[model samples]
Target: MSKIVLYWHPMSSATPIACALAELGVPHERVKVDIHAGEQRKPAYLALNPNGKVPTLTVDGAPMFEALAIHLWLAGQYGVERGLWPAEGTPERLQAMAWSTWSYVTYGAQLVRLQTARDMGTPDDPHGQAGHKAMDELLALLDQRLASQPWMLGANYSMVDLIVGSVIGYSAYIGAPVQKHPHVLAWLGKVQARPAMQIDA
Candidate 1:
């Protein structure tokens, strides 16, 4: 296999891809992109990811961004039969795609909004309230979907769990009220307990 390098910053959204790579058990190197110190905008890093984001993955020196896309690609290339992702053409694979997309685009947007609102003002502010409403509805839906399943794609843990759980876990950090969604909370517990998801002290 070609050399895999992840340009990353700890605890940012980039963390999940690290978890995914660990779950895949692929040998890789980490090149820290210190966003707070403006390293992501340096000429060399920008050449790899014009967006100047952490979690840009370089496979044999070919760069790929978008954390979810990186996750899918890594899983497809190295995780077959390892259960990090469903095999291509299977119905479970399609479901995984849907859930991953939902977690990234739909749920992720509200999380961003809430975080931004927190920086701006109280959760009672217009933007914050809107974020809460949107998240409440989405979490309710997810809670129902997860009501009977141990993981996102039925019984098996897949990339969907890691992807979705990463964003949902942020809710707790951001002080969003998600405890009402029992199933989602329980599912998150299982997702967080994965060995790959743990960070060393």
Candidate 2:
């Protein structure tokens, strides 16, 4: 098998990491961890990623976790430019990283929390409602931003698109609508149309 093995679960955020790898043409074996079955809680997964999160990749024997970090490393190492990043040190690069951070740290957290509450049968939770509000505000902010730039970092489809696009997919899965942002809808349609954009576990 290839040295890189990606431990993932379909029910998690591993989808974006997979999309990034597919964008880069990096072939890795998918180690399915039954998250619902508590597979990720097993000792094996904990050894790889103490956090027990999906998208933990063992690249050439080195373990790397977190979807965005893995994608950034892959983009740099493989020279795969799906418009996910720009040249380092340039204005474009700066903007791309900013948007990428916004997607993961800001928007992604809110969406994940909302989904977690609903998945654990806490759909009507007060915190979940707050998370939904955060999500809506984030989407509105994103929509306003997209009103100008074609992509998150100017008119290019860098890692920003992959990251944000994946978040949009998650929100949709949790009953959050993406139709409100016309630009996002158009951009997401393009991202999802990628042949390598597989929803692999």
lDDT of 2 by residue, 4-108 (tens): 788888756787777777776777888888888888888978999999878798988789888888876776666334445576768876776777778878888
Give lDDT for model 1.
0.85
Residue 146 shift from truth in candidate 1, angstroms? 1.0
For candidate 2, the per-residue lDDT at 70 reads 81
* Alpha-carbon lDDT of model 2: 0.77
State candidate 1's TM-score: 0.95
Please give the range of 10 consecutive residues that has the lowest summed lDDT in model 1.
Answer: 75-84
lDDT of 1 by residue, 1-201 (tens): 799999999888689888888888889899888899999999999999999888899989999999889977887787776867788999988887888889889988898888898987676788888988889999999999999788888878787888889888888679666888899889899889989989641
Which regions of candidate 1 fall more than 4 Å away from where they truly are?
Answer: none
Q: What do the candidate models score in CA lDDT, each in turn? A: 0.85, 0.77
